[model samples]
Every structure is written in structure tokens, then in C-alpha cells.
Target: MKEIVQINLDNEMDLILAHKRCMKIAEMCGMASSLQTRFATAVSEVARCAIAKGKDSLLVLNINIIKATQKEITAIITDNVDLKSCSPDAFIYASKISHHIEYQYSNNQSLTKISLPIPSPGLLSETKIKTLIDYFKFETPLSPYDEIRKKNIELIALSEKLAESENKYKQLANTIPILICVINERNNVLLVNESLENYLDKPLLSFDRKTLMNFIHTEDIDGILEGWNKAKQNRSNFLGETRIKKDSNYIWHLISIVPNKTEDGSFNSWLVYFVDINAQKMMVETLKDNTQLKLIQHELENANSKLRFKNKELEQFAYIASHDLQEPLRKIMIMLSRAGEHLSEDQKKKYYFDRITSAAGRLSNLITDVLNYSRIENKEQYFEKVDLNKIIIDVLGDLSLVIEEKHAVINVNPLPTVFGLDTQLRQLLYNLINNALKFNAKQPSVKVLHENVPKDEHLPIGAENYEVIAISDNGIGMDSKYSNRIFDMFQRLHERDQYGGNGIGLALCRRIIENHNGIINFTSKPDEGTTFWIYFPKNKLYTAKLSLKNQSSN
Candidate 1:
């Protein structure tokens, strides 16, 4: 009698196929056909259990078919499983079927089967039982680490995905647009993107440190050196404007080379993004030429020529208007003087001829102010070192009549020797000091002082040397609203007959300060004094006196 071979099936599909093939083979070996069909039924039941509880694992079943005598075969099958969770009725039902089968296997796996096959009556004939027993005696059970093998497979899949992503990141870095370049801290080229290859018309691998500097323009070499030195010393990002030679043409580029630092605050490399700024540079050059520009004498001459033509027209008009009106005003004044001689005391009281005489005199004064204001600028003249103290003294002497009339106090401080036209500075002092004297309230107290400004006491608006001269006065102060208008010509805040003068004084002051390339601003309040501060920039106008000082000392 031959022994039936032992067979181990890993999973449900393997077990079902193996059982089908063995059943067909067992019947040919003279085993009962009905009992072979019973073995197929049992294998199908185990397959359902394997599918329900095993996600990535499988069910293992061992089967043995034995032949004891011709036409007698018995099968013994074992499955590695547990069924503690099955219902009591199901267990009772399976136990009943186990008693009827020639060889019984328990349904202990997680799945529930609808039916268990019963062996045909007298079908097995006890031939397969002996064969199945011999199969179990030679084989051992499989180990449990088979499930851990699946976990290792999943880990390898994740590792492969991570590697793919890293490669993609490097690929994108080498292909992005803009003039991308990576350089080491020593300014050695590390990588260049494909967009830069398109611009250079060369392959990326050909770009290296050996030929990099040769592409830069010679005129920008020094500036580029200074920028690189600053980056290395400061360990900071370098941004500069430079030109490059490409295909025998120069292109301006704004390069932002930022250092990528190591952990210890030292740079290991740099990232550069170059932007073409040639169009913007050319636009700036065009705008500079368009402005009526340059400190050159020719442009100044052109400006002076325009001013001379306008001034000539204005002076002639003022002279003619003043001459024609003065003649009629003289005749009216002479006739009024004679009329006063003829009228009696009562008639003189009825007629006010003095009003007409004063009105004509005011018109004449306004005309004179308009003429002087229009012709204030002498563009043909040059600045010279002039004693401003002498100018102030002359102004004080010119207004001596008013000082005596009000018994007003006046103080003149030592002034600087500034380089300016004497005519302009003289007019500046005359207008400002006269306003300080004329605007006083009942107390007619006026003081003029000058002092040197300290170097650091300035908020520089532009690049220039400035001297701050504060002209303080004790006058009838003005409010904020009227203070700005007081400098405008013919914009008087009070009636002329009351304040007693033409309003061109402050207007003339503003124009004179402007002609000297200076600014005149003031601070005032109601019932408080006013202080006008003049900011005169130091130029040939102010520094020429230094040479005179040394020569005087010698």
C-alpha cells in the first residue's frame, strides 16, 4: 500500500486549487469519488474564512490523502485558525457534522460557513485515513514572521517614493527661469540654470569659475571688486549694479547675490538672481538731459537771457504808468492847494481835499514798489565777499526817521561776511528790519541779532552746507492763517491807511532770499513776537569770505 503525499497550501485560492486537483487524482487512485467531493467542500468553507479575517495574510491548510486498500481512501486535513467568536448554535451544528464525517476538522477560523459537507455513507472505505496520517508525520508547521515580511515590503515602497521626490527637486532647480546662479563663498560658480544657458547660448556644464569673470565689463570691474570685498568682510548679502559683455554687446544687470550661511554664521555659498535693468538706466539718462539742467555757465546764461527780456518789458511798463499818473496827481494837488486858499473856514470844513491828496500819494507809492519788485534780480552780476554788518547798518540808517518818530530801540549785532551780491543782501536787510520796526505795537522795541550756527544742529534735506541765521523781533505777532500770505505781493492783512505802507516789504524779502538760493521762514503767534530764520546754503556765496579773513589777518 502506498502512502498519500502531504501538501501545504498558503492561502484560500491555493488551497481550493490544490484540493480540486487532489480530488481528481485521488479518485483515479481508487479512492471513493463521493469522499473526494467532500474534501472539495471543506476546502471551499476554509476559503471563505480566509477572505473574511486575513487582509494581507493568508490561511494555511495541510491535507493528506491515504490509500489503505483498493477503492478505499481516507483524507485528514488540518487548518491553523481560531474560532472563539462563533455562535454557540454554529459550534453545536459543526460538532454534529464532525461526528458524522470519517475524519473531522474543526471550523475555528474567523469566517462562518453556510454548510459543512458530510461524507457519503460507506464512501471513504478507510483507505485515505492511513495515507493522511503518514503525511502529517513527516512535515512541520510554518513560522509566524510571514506577516512581518509584508511590513518590510511597504517600507521599501515608501523609501523609493522619497528618492523620486528628491531627484525632482534638483531637476526643477536646474531648469527654472531667471538668471539663476549658485556660487560658493569664494565666488566660485557651483551651478547655473537652463534659462541662463539659453541666454549664454552654451551648455551649463561648460560654465565654471575659470571663464566667469571674463564676461564682465571692464568699467564695472572696480565697483564689482568693492562689492565682493564688502560681502566677504561683512559676511552679508551683496547687491550691486554692473554691466556684462555678451556677444560683443554690453547689458546692464542688477545682481542680488545673497550669501547662504552655514550654521555657525559663516557663509558657505551664495545665490544670485540677475535682473536686466538696461532699459531703466537709459530712461534715467534721458530724463536727466530733459531737465533744464546742469550747473554749467551756458544754461545759466540761457535762463538769464529769458529773465532779461521779461524784466525789460516790466520795467518799461512801470516807468510809463508811474510817469503818466504822477503828472495828473501833481496837477490835482496844486489845484487843491489853491482851492484851500479861496475857501472860507466854513467851506473848508465842508470839503475834504486832503483825502484826495493822500489817496494819490498811496497810488504813487504802490507804483514805485511794483517797479522795484519786478527788477530785483541782477542775473548778470557775480557774488563777492561783502560785509553784511555794513549792509545792516545802512538799513538802520535809512530807516532812522521812523526810529526817531517812535523812539524805538534798535540793536545791531556783528554779522558774517557772506559771499553774495551787495545789492541783494542790502535789500534783504532793509525789508526785514523795516518790517520788524513797522509792525511793533505800542511799545516800539526792535532788535536785530546774528550768530553762527553749530555744525550738528541741522536736519539736512539735501547735500549742502547751511548756515542758520535767526532774525528775532518784538512786533505785533500774526496768526497762523495770515503768516503765509504776508509774503505774497499785494496780499495785505490790514488796510493800507492804517498800517501806513505798501505791502511789498515782505514780498521783496521772499524774492531776495530766493535769488540767493536760500529759504526764509518765520514763527509767530497772536500777541507774541515773530522770528524769521533764514537758511543760507554754504556755496561760493558764503565761503568766499574765508579767503578775505586770512588775507586780512596777514
Candidate 2:
């Protein structure tokens, strides 16, 4: 192989140089003028293809010997273009005029080799090749004016083709409903489609970035700006969902930005597209509203259920109150009437008077218990840190007389400070301890102990971290079947005459515990002792309808 000349095929001027160089080389190799023109035109066609599809295109003229009596002139065009995407026309015309043409691609580049057999191979030798190479090295290139004139002509032809393509693209853009815009690297609006103008109902007068942002909704402006800036900085494609203003209302749009790069891979411009998504967004919002409506309906139903339960409780309390109060009052009246009738029998009258007094006291106690139960509904009380040990001491002091009468032995253990109404908690312990003493047959023995229970215990109430207080007593216990029923108002397992209670104490105790967000349960056997467990959440502070001022008042 022998090399002659190489020309860079960058612009139309370079294209002219590549053609001229090929013709000159062919003439020196003993080719006719007509054949020279044909070969040069073929080389120019392939070189033009290289310029359009790839960058840094080069045209090389060389001579190669095929056999002992054969030599050929070859034109090799190389560029950074993938062969798969390059047009076959790049080689078709060149192949027809040239003896043979070969195409190869590698490393993201294409090489087109076009060869034409020299008519007189014998005239071409090492000496002749040297002459041709020297002729190109010293030959004066095209004058500056001629170069510019040829470039102008090329630009005119290119501009005509670009105008045709732009017209077609504008027709398509205007027919579509999407809003399209082209912006430069500085974010200045370069062009906008007819659809954008029609949507805004006016032509865009300003080409600045701020002017374009005015069309976006105020709430969505920051997000849109941030996304655009990030995509511009990275010179990459971007997609964002935002609300754009239309007339007085805001509509959702999906904005897509595609970047255009120059030959050197630098950002040149950005193509932005806005697609209406208001319909989809509205559908999503409607579904969300329906879900929230369902949740509110469920909450209302639960509140109604609780109200109905409370109403039933009130009805039961009314019936029982009338029966219990009338019984005591009737007995007192009957005893009084008997005492009056047997006025002469001093001993019988004295027995009737005692029976009247006992009945009256029972009635008084029943009224006092009823008042205590009703007081639990008062929500004015506030919560504070209550020491359980102090509560137990106070309850003991109040029940000291009963404890002495029963000769009960009580054991105390250290307890933790909890959050609750002090007065309510004191009443709770008082009722439990009083029951412990009252229900016992033998000498009463009670133990108060405390421990921490973990959330994983899965207690009957639920699994939650709790501070548990166990109050066990060596007292006669009731049937386990009454455990749940005993908490009801006016419910009692034992005979009222034997227990001497109106049956409101345990119910009051349960209510107080509930107000403090705590749980109380007991385990007992008929002959053995009973163990009452009270659990308070370790981390929670219970307060019912606590106002800020009331909370501090405690």
C-alpha cells in the first residue's frame, strides 16, 4: 500500500477539499478526466454521509497493489459513527462507480473503503507515487474567499432542508394537545408550540425564565424549579408532576425535559413537554375522600354503640334502685307501725324500734353508696403523681377500726408512684381492703406486693408495659363465675343481710380504676384466699378531660 493525501471532512468546505484531492490523485494515477470526476463524486457522497451521521470524519487517498500486474486507487472514509445506524446509501453510489467498496465498524466507528482500478497500472510506480505526494504537500489550497463562498452555498442548501423539516414538526406539534417548549442552556425560552399559546389563551411576550414560571401554580413552583435546575445541572432527562395554572384554576401536568447535546457532548438546549394529568389527579383525590368518609362513618358507629351500652346501664340502675330503696323504706314503716300498735308491750316495742333504726341506717348507707357511684361521672378532677404507699396508708387509717375488729394482719411492700386522681385512688384501695376484712371468716391476713410486668405478657386486658400491684387476702372467696358480674352496679353474690353492703363498693372501685386507664382483676378459690391484681401503664399518665390549668391545679 502507498499513501497519497489525507483531508479532514468537517464542513462543506472540507467536503470540497476531499473531492478535489480525490480527483487530483486519480488523474496522477493515469485515470481519464471523466473517470476522475465519477470517482471524486462518489468519494464526496460518502464523505457527506460521514459528516451528517458522525463527528471528526476523515478522507484518506491511497494506492494498493492487488496482484503482479494490477494496482488500484482507494479512498477510505472514517468517522465515529456506528455502522448499524449508518445509511447503506453511503456506500451504494460509491460502490457503483468504484471497482469495489468495503464497509467495517469497530469501537463505535465506521470505515468505508472505496477502490477504483487504475486504467494503466504499469504507469503507476514508486517514483510516480512520490511525485503525487510531493505535489499535494506543496499545492496551494483553496483561497479564503472561495472557501467562504462554497460554505455559503452549502448553508443555503442545508437551510432549505431544515425549513422543510421544521414545517412538518410544527404541524405535528400544533395538532397535538400537549404543551411543548424549547429552551436554551440558560433556561431562556427559545421556542414554544402553538398548543402552549392556545392553552394560555395568549402569545408569550417574554422569553425569560421567570416569565415561563409564571404559568405554574404558586404552590408547585418551588418543586418545578428545583427539578428543572437539577436536570439542567446534570444535563440529563427529567420528569416531574406539577400543577400549572390555567385561567383562574390550577391543573395537574406531567412535565418531561429532554436534553440536546452538541458534538462534544455539551448541553445545547432542552425540549420540555407538559401533559395534562388533571383527570387522573382528580380521580385519586376522589378515592382518598371516599376512604376518609368511610373512616368517619366507622367512628360514628362506634360512638353510637357506646352510647347505647351506657343507656342500658342507666335503665338497669333505675329499676334496681327503685326496688332496693323501697324494700328498706317499707321495712322501716312496718316496724314503726308495729311499735305503735304494741305500745303496751315494752320489750316488743323496743325490738320493733331497734329494727326500725337498723332499717333506716341501711337505707342511709344505700343512699351514700349511690351518691359515691354518681360522683364518678364528675370530670372536673385533675391528675397528679400519686404515691401508692401513701394511698395505702390513708386507706388503712380510715379502715383502722374495722381492721382491729377483725384482728386482720396486713403486710405492706414498697410501691411505685403513679399518675391519677389522689382522692379516687384512695377510695379504690379503701373499698378493696375493707372488703378483704369484711369477707373473712378467720383472722384476716392480707399482703400487698408490687412488680413490673412486660408488654409481652399478653395479659387478659391487653399486652402493655405495666406496674402491677397484687393484693392477696386470706379471706373467704366467692365463686369464680361472679368475677365479671360483680363489677356491675347493685350486683352481689352473697346475701345482703350477711354481707351488710349495698353492693356499690366494688363497682365504684372498678370505675375509678377505669378512669385512671388501669386494669383490675382477681383470682380466688372458695375456701382459699383471693388475689386482686391492679395494673397501671408504666409509661402513661392518665387524665380524663384534663385542661392545662386543671392539670396543674392538682
Candidate 3:
């Protein structure tokens, strides 16, 4: 058996890094992707449980060779939580994924161990194990404070090497692809590469720190200085992009400066490298321009589409108005003209006058319904918190006379407070109630009920909680074949002379419900009562705002 690595299960980030390391090691051991994922998941679950339920938990990994041909990878998670008090489901899941699992408890501490057997012809040779051990020896589990101290020691040793390699650096810099320079503690240029000299077309020995700043673009001077100062203070690397003057034009370059520190943790100097990235920057700018052009073209197409739709709607409205509205007025005019010329008895005149009056009434109703439908499209309504019960009561009060005339009996259940346009909701209720009473033959019995419902495939996207409001009425209903057609503008199943309607009531109701991000449908049969179901989203206010934003953007 050989110890591989250990990690402290302290926080969420640590747990995440631990799992990543486990997966990486499993991959190095020639494990398949599925097996690697299983090991990582099992390690994460055990480590998370240990961190949540216990204190000072540690996760250890090891490799053991069996029969000189097979290898087994194991993880041991130790915590202070009592074994009996721990979650059983987590271990059971781990057991299913792993080959073997065991729990050990003693001296107020508990250990959960999981192992997976590797396929034959294991990849963990002696040389590979040595490399892994050497790479991870200093990376063993340590307190955060100890880790910082170790990093500081490494930095100090690197500083000594930088000071001693002046000649060797000069020889190596000439062959590198990037331009390199060294800046001393006093912020003066100590040395520069041949590449830098060739690019600037000047001798490195003649230029100083101030001369170098003159070559950088004026807009980027402050930003570059700020990044440099921050890196100096933190004893870290500074990375930035800026334009540098070359010949008569400016070109982009990526600057990277690595700080060298003294043994006492003080700043020594910076080793800076300049990488030419003008081609990459130009490509990015070109792509951005193309993307912007595509977006503008898409917007133009959307605008054209909307214009076409609006024009079609206007044409249909004009056709309907010229035919439907004028027909009634034409009949009235012809009837009155005949009555005036005949000069008959009172009964004959009364018959023609009544016909004229009925024609005029139908014309008036057509105009009113058209105006109401048009208002629904053109007017912008404000949404607010509305009580359904209050709206129902108000509607009932308004239709009290008609209800009494029909002897209609309405049963209302407790309703909910929903977000909607107040006036529109009231109009919707009024239309539905009036239609139920007008079409009924016997004593009209209507039931209004509402209840919360789950989200289903029928609900619109972004709908979370919904309310289904059903209005059932014992009225003369139409055939089921006209279910979808009933909501169309001026679509009347019954003849106007019999039903006494312009066919805009249901259409208007449909539009109002749609504006609130809801859907309306009904079930009806000839002689059977109709039950209209309206599905209203509880969070209509949010969806409404989103809709407005989308429209405005388009």
C-alpha cells in the first residue's frame, strides 16, 4: 500500500477541489470516464456528509497492489460523528457504486472507507507511483496558514535564482518568441531581450523606464500603471492588454509581469514579457462587427413582419365594418322609405316601423361590440392585485335585474386574490354571466369555482403556480365542433335573430384573458350546460412585465 494524497474537508470549495483531484488521479490510473465519475461522486458525497455532520474531517486516498497484477484505489473519510447517527442512505448509495465499502468506529470517531478494483494489467507502475508521490508530497493536507508559509518560502527561493541567472537569461532570451525585459527595484529598466530591441528599433542600453512608457498608447498608461502597482503590492503576477507604438502605427500586445521577491518577503524586481496579439484582437473585432450587423438585420425583419400583420388586421377590420355594419343600416333605410310612400293604416305602419327599429338596434349593437374589441387591443391597462370575490359581487350587482328576470341561481365559492387588470377582469365576468342568463331556458343555475392547479404541458412557459377558474351554467349550449371557432371575432353559432348577440362577447373575453397571460376553453353539447375553464397564472404580473419588455425590444 502507498499513500497517495490527503485533503482537508473544511468548506465547499475544498470539497469541490478534492473531488476534481480524485477524478484526475483516477484518469491517470487508466480508469474509464464512467469509473472516474463514479469515484468523484462517491468522494464528494462522503466528504460533504463528513463536513456537515462532524468536525475536523480528513479525506485520504491510497493505492494498493494485489497479486502483482491487480490494483485497488481506496478512499477513507474520517469524522467525529457517531456511526449510528450518520445517514444510512448516503453509504448505501456509495456501496452500490463502489466495489467494497466499510464503516469503522472506535474512540468516539467514525471512518467510512470505499474501494474500487482496477482492471487487470494495472497502469500504476513503480515509476508512475514515484512520480505521483514526488509531485504530491508537499501538497499533503495542511492548515490554510501553513499553506501560505510554504508558498512564501517557494517565492523566496525563486528570487535567489532570478538574481543569479543574468548571463544565462541573456543567452536564452534571444531565442524566445516574446519580448522580455527586467525592471529593478528602483523602477529602471535593467535589461531587455534582443526581440524587444528589434521591435522598438532602438538599442536596449539607451532606453529607460520613462522611454518605455512613451511607446505605450496614451489611453492605456494609467490602467497599465494601476495593474503594475497592484501586482507589486500583492507580490503576484500582473497581466494586461495595451497598444504599443511600432513604426508609425499602434498594435496590441499582452503584457505579463512576474514579481521576484526577497527572502524577507520584500519586492525585488519584475520580469516582464510582451506577447504580440494584434491578429487575435483584429479577429475578435471583426466577429463583433458581424454579430452586430446580424442583430440589426434581425430587428429589421421583425419590424417588417409586425407591420405586415398590422396591415392584414386593418384590412380584415375594414371588410367586416363595410359588410356587417352597413347591412343593418341599408335594411332600415329601405324599410322606412317604403313605409313613408305607402301611407297605409296604423297596423301597416306599425309593422314597418317595428322592422326599422329592430334594424337600427342591431346596427347600434354591432358598432358597440366593434368599439369594445378595438379598445381591448389599443388601450394599455395597468395591472394590480385584485380580489376575485369582489369582482364577482360587483358583476352580480350590475346584472341583478337580468338575473331576477331569468330567475337565475348563482352559486359562488371562495375565490382567490390574483394579479390582473381590474376593469378588464370585471368586463370578463360581466360578459360570461350575462351570456349564461340570456341563453338559459329553465331557471338558470351557474356555479363559479376556483382552485390551485399544478403546472402541466398545457400551461404556458414560465408559468409556475396556476389557478383554474371554472364557470358552469345550465344554458342552451352549442355543438362541440365550434369549440375553437367560438372565440373568433363575430363568430356566432346561432343566428343573430335567435341568440340576440353580435358575437363579440366571447371574443372580447378571450382577448382579456390572453392579456393576463391566461387561456380560456369551454366544453358544451346541444341542450347540455356549458362549462368554461380559464387557466390564470398566479404570477401573471411577472410574466406580463416580461412580455412588455420583449415587445419593446422587438
> Clash pairs of candidate 1?
66-131, 72-127, 73-128, 74-127, 74-128, 74-129, 82-108
Candidate 2, 208: how far from true, in Å? Answer: 83
Tens-place lDDT per residue, model 2, 1-554, is 88888888777777767776777898788875446666776777788777777788888899898875899999988888863267677577666656577888888788888888988888887888899889888765543323323333332333344345446545644765678888886667788888787787556654344665778766677777777888878877889897878888888888998886542335688888887766556555655676667655665566466556645555445344544455445544454554345334553332234554565577667767876776675342476778999999988999899888888899999988987888888888888888888888899999889865443322443423567888989888978777756787777667767777878898998888777777777789997989888877665543322122323555
User: Model-by-model lDDT, in order?
Assistant: 0.56, 0.71, 0.70
Candidate achieving higher lDDT, 1 or 2: 2
Using lDDT, give the best candidate's number: 2
> 421-467, model 1: which lDDT tens digit per residue?
78878888887777777777766666666665443423334324555
* Local error of candidate 3 at residue 33 (angstroms): 88
The runs of at least 3 residues in candidate 2 whose Cα sits more than 4 Å from the true structure, single-residue gaps closed, are 1-351, 378-381, 453-458, 461-464, 541-554
When 1 and 3 are scored with lDDT, the better candidate is: 3
Q: Which clashing pairs does model 3 show?
A: none
- Residue-level lDDT of model 3, residues 160-248, one tens digit each, is 33334434434543755578888875567788878787788555542234565668888888888888778777777989998989988
